[model samples]
Target: MIHAQTLVDAHLYPNQEAVMADALRALLHDKPQLRIELAIHRYQTEDLSLAQAAHIAGVSFDRMKALLLARNIQLRLGPADADEARKEIAEMERIIARRELP
Candidate 1:
């Protein structure tokens, strides 16, 4: 199999990072389930909200909720504590400032 460095050497991609990004896009396109899995993993392990996971998975918010429920994953509808609430609010503000809200 051709390595990312080989693609870079051939000038097909600007660099290894570009090659990896393209490969990831293609792989995620071909295996759409991977997108959802990745999103779910991030939501479960990271501080991401459900909406963020849905965005990453390219699914509706409700759909992501259902997927999470179907997998028996407990929902974190709102922040569990003051610090988390603050973080969530800060993230929301950042998204709004960037005009990233849908």
Candidate 2:
């Protein structure tokens, strides 16, 4: 934190606010989401359900399902979901290879 006198000195300058904002952005950027997540989990010590965890993370249910699948946790069990997983994998691969690229 800055000294109170420094803030008082910069009271009349718009650029001082911008400088503080840039510094804050730089500070946050240094930590990755995984680091932040682990720290939060360790401190809060709450074993939230996957859906609840996703909501806390500010992501949609579908995105959280994808994240679980990435971590090899099943969203559902049995044959139909296997077919759906194959389809999703194929679609993701196609999209990754072609849809968003030249």
Candidate 3:
């Protein structure tokens, strides 16, 4: 194992190195596949890139994109856009529900 100082001396971004290793470790662990949609959503809202978010969530980039697509979530849209979409859907649902209420 390399010493922290030595790693630092190599002029690497500490957190980046740590997180990357963590992501790889987690992705390789024996376990059920994680829900990539939820992970991507959270990471997007928290300021992570698609690749970075995938790593942060410990999934492959391809897997993350596939999950987003399967869930009908657009990867190009920001979280704020997603929130607006959610609100619009909620309003539409409420209107529909009220129409049936007599």
lDDT values of the candidates? Answer: 0.89, 0.53, 0.60
Error of 2 at 96 (Å): 34
Model 1 residue 69 lDDT score: 99
Off by over 4 Å in 3: 1-38, 77-102
**Alpha-carbon lDDT of model 3:** 0.60
Q: Is candidate 1 or candidate 3 better by TM-score?
A: 1
lDDT (C-alpha) at residue 85 in model 3: 65
Q: Model 3, range 21-71, lDDT digits (tens) per residue?
A: 755666646443553544666765755445555654556778777877877
- In model 1, where do residues sit more than 4 Å from their true spots? 79-102
Please tell me which predicted candidate would have the highest lDDT against the true structure. 1
TM-score of each: 0.75, 0.31, 0.36
Residue-level lDDT for 20 in candidate 1: 89
The residue pairs in collision within model 1 are: none
Lowest lDDT sum, 10 consecutive residues, model 1, at 93-102
Q: How accurate locally is residue 83 in candidate 2, as Cα lDDT from 0 to 100?
A: 71
